[model samples]
Target chain A: MRIVVQEAPFDFAAEAQGFSRGLSGMGAVVTFSGLVRDDDGRLAAMEIEHYPGMTEKAIRAIAEEAQARWSLGDLLVIHRHGLLAPGETIMMVATAARHRAEAFEAAEFLMDYLKSRAPFWKKELTADGAEWVAAKDEDEAALDRW
Target chain B: MDVLYFAWVRERIGLPKERVETSAATVRELVDELRAREARYEAAFADLSALRVAVDQDLADFDAPLAGVRELAFFPPMTGG
Candidate 1:
């Protein structure tokens, strides 16, 4: 398992390939990437803030839970912080397992937990001003399924 | 103890973190003391439901004890993914 909290943008394709390569007995791999969305085309950039000491700890706990609940070969989580333009990658999660079901389920589980549990906050910047993005009720509700 | 703020809480309070000396026994009591300090703190902590708290870097409720906690953080619900 690997967890990365960084401000520098990551090369998704390279990271994905690196995560899946040279794995023995792992028959399936699942990957998910989140991107900044400019829904109204008014978004100038997104400013991400996170608790330096707590962010890594929280994400590691979530990843460890995923590992315990699923039969897997490996998992990877990479989250970026700081300013980012629309369409840029925000984060990515990858899970490798002996079968697709476990891989996919673990990936989704990681996402759901990371959405509401992590300490990162996002602020949307536009021409008019900036507004903090609110957490959705649906996002919290999504945790109940697991 | 160290008190930290994030997102709008930091903006409203006008600082990211500060050293706090207090005899508060719980998170709620600490918040009350902070609210009494200044109007900016009052405004930042106006709605308890709109904020979340962490004790020593772990999420906790306002009613949680702060007996041995060295760090406390207040922020809005996380929007991470």
Candidate 2:
């Protein structure tokens, strides 16, 4: 299990390459990427802020939980903090498991928990001004289902 | 007692961090004690509506005891993705 939380951009290709390094048995690698989206359909970019210690702990815990639930060989969760552009990637999750179901389900579970459970706050920069986005009820609902 | 503020909670508090000491028992008790300490704490904690509390490095509740907790953090609802 590998988890990295930093401000610099990440190389998805490199990460995918690393994920494919040790594959001896029949398996699948499920990957997911989260981007800065204009939820309000506003402008410029998104400013993401996070508590360094808490953010890492929360993400690591999520990864650990996923590993406990599945027989994963390699797991990588990369998250970026600070300012990010609209098209820029904010985070990525990769799960390597023996079967497609476990790999995909574990990746999705980690993403869902990270989005709603983790301690990251985002503010949208628009033509008008900047406003912090609230935790939507739908997000909470999504996690509750899982 | 270095009080660390984080995320939107720090933005609203207008200070990223501060330090203080008090004879509060639990996390909730410390909050009440801080609210009484000054106007800044009161304003910062004016609305516990959306606030989340953490003791040491673990996600704790307002009612969680802070007797031996080293670091205390306060923040708003998480928005991580």
Q: Which candidate ranks first by DockQ, i.e. highest?
A: 1
Q: In lDDT terms, which candidate is top?
A: 1
State candidate 1's DockQ: 0.93
How many residue-pair clashes does candidate 1 contain?
Answer: 0
Error of 1 at A139 (Å): 0.4
Best by TM-score: 1
Residue-level lDDT tens digits of model 1 in A28-138: 999999999999999999999999989999999999999999998999999999999999999999999999999999999999999999999999999999999999999
Give Cα-based local distance difference scores for all models.
0.97, 0.83
Error at B11, model 2, angstroms = 1.6
* Runs off by more than 4 Å, candidate 1: none
lDDT of 1 by residue, B1-81 (tens): 999999999999999999999999999998999899999999999999999999999999999998989999999999999
Candidate 2 residue-wise lDDT, A22-136, digit = tens: 7777389988888888665676888888877878888888989988988887898998988998889999989888899999998988988998778788888899988888888
Please give the distance, in angstroms, between residue A83's alpha carbon in candidate 1 and its true position after superposition: 0.4
Q: In lDDT terms, how accurate is model 2?
A: 0.83
Each prediction's TM-score versus the true structure: 0.99, 0.92
